[model samples]
Target: MLTILPPSFTLTDDSLQELLLSSSSSSKSWSAREEACYLIFFSGTLPVLPGSHTASIAGQKEEEEEEEEEAQGDPLSESQLTSLKEGLWCPDCRAALLAVLSIFSPGSLAATTASSTSTSTSTTTGAASAVEARALLLQVSREQWKDRTDGGHVYRKRYDVQSVPTVLKWIGGKEVGRLVDEECADVDKIRALVQG
Candidate 1:
């Protein structure tokens, strides 16, 4: 329900400069641009209003739910839906993609983010993980995420990312440590993620 971003084509518009005052932080500007990307995926949608009870979702997740039959997109098998739960809230595919977007802070790493192009185009590719991460999140509703045939399955196999909100500490290209799920939400654990 938050689709307020202007089209990406407007991102470079010279006329829009009038909206910025000198004190505005560049970070805020970047964050604004990023919102446009969130719109590209429907991850910005709130299934039920925030701070309310969680509801079941049916289609196009990074996602929310109600009325599985009324949910948009193709239906997932019970077994398949169960598999997706590890990485997504309610195992919605849309959540899978949103999880990836949540991974690193802007400029936090000299990182490569594999981004799928818009439909009917070639998805961005480079690092094996980039492409893998993109595919996993983009096609949550289209395939069995943990199945051998799913590319995300392959990516997770390499990193051992079995669930959502996993934080990996990669030092010099080798994984030094990791914090999974609830551990990531703890203040002390987050400090330890970098310190211990």
Candidate 2:
């Protein structure tokens, strides 16, 4: 069974301390051997989208409000909405991550497992089984770029990640593949890398 370690930021201070202690001690609780496949997402490269803003014109406030309401009533196209969500980035790394998660999340895996078992006498193939196995997903914050020595520094150094939006694939603690920056924006490419 593969054990996916949650991101450090998500853990409480006590849990983090315990995790650190366990990691540092000779008897490692979370071994790479246990979870052969892992995916690390360096999220620093992706630009943060600005919060929604409201502007008021001194004289034309009512007219501007009416226009704004009309504009809001007309929904944006899928591509336009995606572009707006992605902000300055050409490709949406966050969207790509969400896509990957949708496919490989625990819920999806459970569904796959149930379906495979319920089907006729066909046994699960190695590739399919591997796909069914949940891969560890870790998100490294963009703030890590500011302090190179902290916040996933070990992984950053090990993977030779120079920028954000880098997705590194590891099997048995060894890096098997990587997709950097805009390259990681493709869901098909990510699926191929993970399955490959």
Residue lDDT tens for model 1, 48-154: 21111122223433333342224333323334333434533333333332223222111111222223211112322222122211001112222333365545653
After TM-score superposition, what is the CA distance of residue 152 in candidate 2 from its true location, in Å?
9.3
Q: List the residue pairs that clash in candidate 2.
A: 44-142, 45-164
Instruction: Write the residue-wise lDDT of candidate 2 on 1-196 in tens digits.
Output: 1222423434323443344334343343333443334444544222111111113324655864565455443223345434533642323454453334333432222334323332223332233334643343344544544475554455556557666556666544466788777666554565577667
All candidates: TM-score: 0.30, 0.44
| Superposed model 2: Cα runs more than 4 Å off | 1-36, 44-92, 106-130, 148-152
Q: Give the lowest summed-lDDT range of ten residues in model 1.
A: 131-140
lDDT at 43, model 1: 16
lDDT of 2: 0.43
**What C-alpha lDDT do the candidate models reach, one value each?**
0.30, 0.43
Alpha carbon lDDT at 98, candidate 2: 34
